[model samples]
Target: MILARVEGSVVATKKNAKMTGNKFLLVRPLVIDSPTAKEWKPGTSTLVVTDSLGAGEGEIVLIVQGSSARLAADDKDSPVDAVVIGIVDTVDVGKHILFKAQ
Candidate 1:
């Protein structure tokens, strides 16, 4: 799994039959400065992910890819490469609190 922030949403008028009702979101991966970092920073690249948990823009989320993503989706057969599995509330790294949702 990876930590990411929802940057925005994606609307597709036409898509694969299996992905008819899925909601897509643009997410930027979050990276820590170090193992004991006090904050999270957004990575340079972005990814389009399928969301089922109603995650909103600016919210930190947990993402799963590949086969795990397929399993996370309501339809296991949905053509998904990534999926938002959880909305993050906090992230504690060792003795440091890296993130806390507001």
Candidate 2:
């Protein structure tokens, strides 16, 4: 699993049958400054992930990639390389609280 933030969304009018009903979100991976640091840095890259949990933009989310992403969705055969599995509420790094959803 990877830690990411929902940056935006995507719309594909023409897609595969298995992915017809799914919503896609643009996400940017979050990188922790260090094991003892209480800050997160945005990644340089972004990706589109299937939103399985209805995550909204600007919300921190958990993303599953590769084969695990397909398994997270209802249709295992869907062409999904990444999926938003969970909406993060808080992030505690060691003894420091890095993030807490407001």
Error of 2 at 12 (Å): 0.8
Q: Per-prediction TM-score, please?
A: 0.92, 0.93
Top-scoring candidate (lDDT)? 1
| Candidate RMSDs in order | 1.3, 1.3
Candidate 1: how large is its RMSD? 1.3
lDDT of 1 at 38: 72
- Measured on C-alpha atoms, candidate 2 has an lDDT of 0.89
The count of backbone overlaps in candidate 2 is: 0
lDDT of 1: 0.92
Model 2, 1-102: lDDT tens digits are 999988999999999888888899999999977655878899999999988688999999999998898788866777889988899999987787888899
Candidate 2 weakest ten by summed lDDT: 31-40
